[model samples]
Target: MKLKGIHHVSAITGTAAGNVDFYTKVLGMRLVKKTVNQDDTSVYHLFYGDERGNPGTELTFFEFPNAWRSRPGTSSISSVSLRVPGDAALNYWHHRFVQYEVDHDDITERAGRLTLAFRDPEGQRLMLVSDEHDTGIAGGKPWVKADVPAEYGIVGLGPVQLTVSRAERTERVLTQLMGYTKKGQYASAIAGQPDIVVYETGEGGSGTEIHLEERSDLPQERQGIGAVHHVAFRVDDEAELRAWIDRVGAAGLAHSGFVDRFYFKSLYFREASGILFELATDGPGFDTDESLDALGESLALPPFLEPHRARIEAGLRPIGTGSPS
Candidate 1:
C-alpha cells in the first residue's frame, strides 16, 4: 500500500490563546478541533485545518505554556509549507502579512514554484507555496467563513523540509524503508551548501514531497515553542496503516505500532537521523465526535479520556477569550 501525502504536522506552541488567535484570526484556518494532548492530558492540543479537518489539511499544536523559543539546528523538521491557490494568492497573502505586521520575506521561487516565507509571532518557520501548476494530489477547499477571501485562503499542507546532519541515512529510510521516490534536487538558500534533495510518495506533487537539506554546519535542535514535533504521512485506512506497521517492523525500526488515535490510527517511528515520522489513517476524522458547525467550540476528549474531562478542564487556561496572561 502506498502512503498518501502528508496527513498533518504537529508543532509546539507557548500559549493556546495566542496560537488560536494567530492561526484562526490571522491565517484564517478553521479551528477544527480543540482537544487535549493524548499523551499529556493536562495541556491543550489544538488542530487547525480546512473546514472539515481533512487529512492533508491539518496543522496541529501541543501547548506548553510559557515555553522557551526553539533553538534551530540540524536533525529537525525545519520548515512547514502551506498550500495556496495560485501566484495571485501569493500576492494576496504578501499584502495581508504586511497589513497584519507578520514577519515575512518577499515572495520567491523554490523548486519551480512561487513561495512566501514567514514566521508566526513565536518564530515558527513557515512557507506558503503556490499550486498554480500543481497536478497531482488535490488540495482541500478553504473554510468559507474565514476572514481571508476563499480564493486566497490557505488550503492544505505542502512539502515539509527536514534538516539533518546525515542526509544519506535519512534518505535511505525514506527511499528503502518508507517507499518514497527521489524526485529531484534544488539549490539550497544557504550559500556553498550541497543541493537539497526532493522525495515524493503516492500521487507526487507539492503535497507529497519532502525537501531534505543536509547541513554539517549546525548543532542538534532544542525543541520548545515554534518547533515542529513530528510530521505524519497519510494512509488510506486502518488496513493500510496496519500493513505499514508490519513493514516498519520488518525493517527492524523501533516503532509505536497500532496506536488508535480516535480520529485516526497511527504508527510512529524515527528515521536514522532521529526525526519523528508518523503514518496515519485518513478516515474516522474530526467530525466523528462533533458536528460540523460546532467544532472547536469546546474541548474534545477521546472516549478513554472522557472519564477525566473534569480534571483535564480544570488544568487548562481558557482559550479564545483573549490572550493568556
Candidate 2:
C-alpha cells in the first residue's frame, strides 16, 4: 500500500494563549481542535488546519509552559513549511507579514520555489513556499475569519525539512519502506547546510515533500518549546494502515503498533536519524466527535479520557477567545 501524505506535524509550544493568538489571528489557520494530550493529560493539544481540518492541512502543538529553548542540531525537524498559491500570493503574504508586524525574511528561491521564511512567537521556524503547479486559489480552502483574504491565505502544509546526522539511513527508509521517490536535491539552500535531498510521495501535493539535510558535524537536538515532536505520514484507511504495519515489520523497523487516537490510528517509530515518524490512518477524521461549525469550540476527549474529563479540564489552562468561528 502506498502512503498518502503527511497527516500532521506535532510540535511543542511555550504558551497556549500565545500559540493560539499567533496561529489563529496572525497565521490565519483555523484552530480545528482544542483538546488535551491523551498521553499527557495536563497540557493542551491544539490543532490548526485548513477550513475542514483536512489531514494534510493539520499542524498541531502541545502546550509546554516553562519549557526551555530547543537545542537545534541534527536529527530534528527544524522547520515546517506551508504552501501558498504563487508569486502573487507570496507578495500578498509579504505585505501581510509587514502589516501584522510579524518577523519574516523577504522572498527567496529554494529548490526552484519562492519562499518566505519566518518564525513563530516561540521561535518555531516556518516558511511559506509558493507552489507553481498549484491552480487552487491561494493554495486551498481558506478560513473565513482570517485577517488575510481567502485568495491570499495559505493553501495548506507544504514540505517539511529535517536535519539529520547522516542522510543515508533516513533516505533508505523513506525510499524503500515509505513509498517515496527522490524528486531532486539542492546544494546549500541554507547557509552551512549541505545538499538537501527532496523525497516526494503519493502524487505529491502540499504535504508530500520531505527534505533531508545531512549534517554529521552538528550535535543531537534536545527537546523543549519549538521542538517538533513527530512527523506523521498518512494512510488511506485501516486496511492500508495494516499493510504499512506489515511493511514496517518486513523492513525490520520497530513501531509502536496500532494506537487508537479517536480521530485516527497511529503507528509511531523513529527513523534511522532518530527523528520520530508516525504512520497515521486518515479515516474517522477530526469531525467525528464534533460538527464542522462547532469544532474547537469546546474540549474533546477520547473514550478512555472521557471518564476524567472534569479533572483534565480543570488542570489545563483556558484557551483564549476571539478565535476563528
Candidate 3:
C-alpha cells in the first residue's frame, strides 16, 4: 500500500472573492469547484487546479471571513509549490507577476530546479518550480481557456515545505510510518540552521517530494488567514484508503477514519509535529456533479448538503467564477 504523490493542499483565506481573483485571475488556474466547507456549510471552500481539476493539481482554500493574518513560524506548512512547464515558464511568470503587481522574488534555484517565489495579497507563501528536469509522476494539463498561454501556465503541485521545531519526530512519521524515503538534503535558505531534508514516496520527483525544514528560531504557527490547513497525499481509491486507515491506527496515531468526501474518500491524521496530513483518493473527481464544460460556474454541494442549498447559498457572498471582469 504505497501512497501516490500530493493530492491537494488546502489553506485558509479571509475573503473568498479576493481569493478567487488572485488564484484564478493572477495565477491562471481554473476555479474547478465552488463549494462550501462540508463541515461548516457556511463559508466557501474554493478549489483551483489544472484543466479538469486532476488529483495532484488541486489547491484549495477555506474562507474564514474574519480570520486574522497568519504569523509565519515553525510547525507550519510554510510554503506551497506549484509546477510549471520549465525554466522558460518561470521567466514568463516573473514578467507576468510584474505586470500584475504580485509580490515575488527573482527566479532562483532551489533543490536543483529554477523556482520563482511569490505570495498572494494575503501573504500566503508560494513558489513556482520548474519541471524541466522532472521525471517522476507527470503533471496536469493547463486549462485551455486560461488567459495565460498553455505552455507557461501553472501545471500541478510540487514539493511542499514543512517547517517544524522538531524535525526528527516528523521525519520518523514520514519514513517509518508513511513510507517516504529520505532522498537528500539541501542548504536551508536561513543561515545557522540545519539543512532542509527531502523525502519522496511513489514515483519520486518534484511532485512526489516533501522538503522538511527544521527551524527552532520561530514560534508555533497560529492558524488564520493565509495559513495552510492541511496537505493531502494521493491514494488510488477507497480500498487503499481503508488499508491506510488500518495502518495509521496500528501505528497508534489518532485519525479521522474513512471519511466519504463525495468527490473522494479521505483519511486524515496529524503527524508527530502537529502537521495535519490527509490520505485522499484520486477519483470520483470534480466532474462528479458538475460537467467538465461548466465546472466552478455554480456552487456545488454533496448529495447530503443539496437539501440545504438555499440556506447555504443565502449565507455566502457571491464569488463569481470564470475570468475576472
Please give the RMSD to the true structure for each candidate, in Å: 1.7, 2.5, 1.9
Model 3: per-residue lDDT, tens digit, 103-199? 9999999888999999999999999999999889999999989889999998999999999998999999999998999998999988899999999
Model 2 lDDT per residue over 1-325, tens place = 8777777999999899889899989889998898888888998899998887888888999998978999888889988998876778889888878888888998988877888998787788899988776422233487888887887777788889989887889988899878789888888655776798888888775568898888867799987998899999988888888788888888887888888899999888888888899998876988998999977888888788888887887787776654322
Listed in order, each prediction's TM-score against the native is: 0.98, 0.94, 0.98
Q: What's the CA error at residue 5 for candidate 1, in Å?
A: 0.7
Q: Please report the TM-score between candidate 1 and the true structure.
A: 0.98
Candidate 2: deviation at residue 156, Å?
Answer: 1.1
Clashes of 1: 0
Q: Which tens-of-lDDT digit does each residue in 1-325 have in candidate 1?
A: 8888999999999998899999999999999999989999878999999999999999999999877889999989999999999999999999999999999999999998999999999999999999999878999999999999999999999999999998999999999988899988999989988899999999999999999999888999999998999999999999888999899999999999899999999999999999999999998999999999988877889999999888888888988674211
| Sliding window of 10 residues with minimal summed lDDT for model 3 | 316-325
Spell out the clash pairs found in candidate 1: none
**What 10-residue stretch in candidate 2 is worst by lDDT?**
131-140
State in Å the error of residue 217, model 3.
Answer: 0.5
